[model samples]
Target: MQGDSRAFEAVIKSTERLVGQIVGRMIGNAEDRKDIIQDIYLNTFKHLPGFRHAARLSTWIGHIAYNTCLNFLEKRRLILPGENFLPEEEENAQASNAIESLIAHKQLTAILSEKLALLPPVYRTLIVLFHQEAMSYSEIGEITSLPEGTVKSYLFRARKQLKEHVLTAYKKDEL
Candidate 1:
């Protein structure tokens, strides 16, 4: 965003959907997600001067989004319960089928989120920078101050963890 408030507003408007999705997935409550989104915008505006334009603007904003969500959850003393943040509805057979589908998606997402959280902050940040934000390994190394080899290793480990979790979950479902 430029120094202009209108420009910043435009950026927020354009990115709110993405920001909301990230925040919603992390926090899982509509009101809390909105609060977290506002916090992210405020943090972005506050830290705008420190932004060196070394990364894509979206990547920069995404970094802010991730941190904001984490901080909010931390402040609220929340634990990342291993449940998919599916919409609440009554339990009927059709609803059960829908819930299963939603839970399957949520389970995968939750497992990845939990595994990523288990990683050290540096590894987690790099994994998100590379996978979630689609940054190049070199770019992640630059952003994270890690070697490219380290970035690759961390990504490999993270992906392996995700694979194991998903496979185990699938097997449990099958039984």
Candidate 2:
């Protein structure tokens, strides 16, 4: 994320899929997802200097993505009680089964999204960075300004919440 525009473009190209998935899960609509993705890129550029090598580039960009989505939600007053976003179409799914499969997928995604959204923004940010982006707790702490222990606690609670939600959904589906 330096020097040549090509480098920046490369970074975006590599990370766009992950960023879009994360933002799409947070913001839902295609139009808003695109807007939030653009905002993430812009913020990444603006904050690149302050991004010390304390965390992975992916984690750093993820921090930017989370903050950008929060700002967008705040600006629009769209922050719902729980995760209110929709999942994007899975590109690999076949046309015939797409609708059904997407619905099932969306249900799971929505459960996870709701649990994630219920967390405080700081913990939500940590969960996204650690689980979604596959960053280490230390790296997440670096990006979030939290202690490593606190990051671990947040992740633990996040996982517990997600587990409870999935279990509840599974039980409902069984009935």
- Clashing pairs for predicted structure model 1, backbone only: none
**Per-model TM-score on C-alpha atoms:** 0.55, 0.62
Task: Please list the residue runs of candidate 1 whose C-alpha ends up more than 4 Å from where it truly belongs after superposition.
Answer: 1-3, 13-25, 73-132, 141-150
The candidate scoring highest on TM-score is 2
Model 1 is weakest, by summed lDDT over 10 consecutive residues, at 80-89
lDDT of 1 by residue, 1-175 (tens): 5577998898798767556545655665778777778888988888888889888666577667877776776787665322222222333443223334544655656667765554334445555556666778876665445588877876776555544444445557667
* Local accuracy of candidate 2 as per-residue lDDT tens digits, 36-110: 788889878877778788767876786677667767777877643235422223333232333334346556666
Kindly state the number of residue pairs that clash in model 1: 0
Q: Model 2: runs farther than 4 Å from truth? A: 1-3, 46-55, 77-128
Our model 2 lands, by Cα RMSD against the true structure, at 9.6
lDDT of 1 at 62: 68
**Candidate 2 whole-model C-alpha lDDT, 0 to 1:** 0.65
Model-by-model lDDT, in order? 0.62, 0.65
Number of the top lDDT candidate = 2
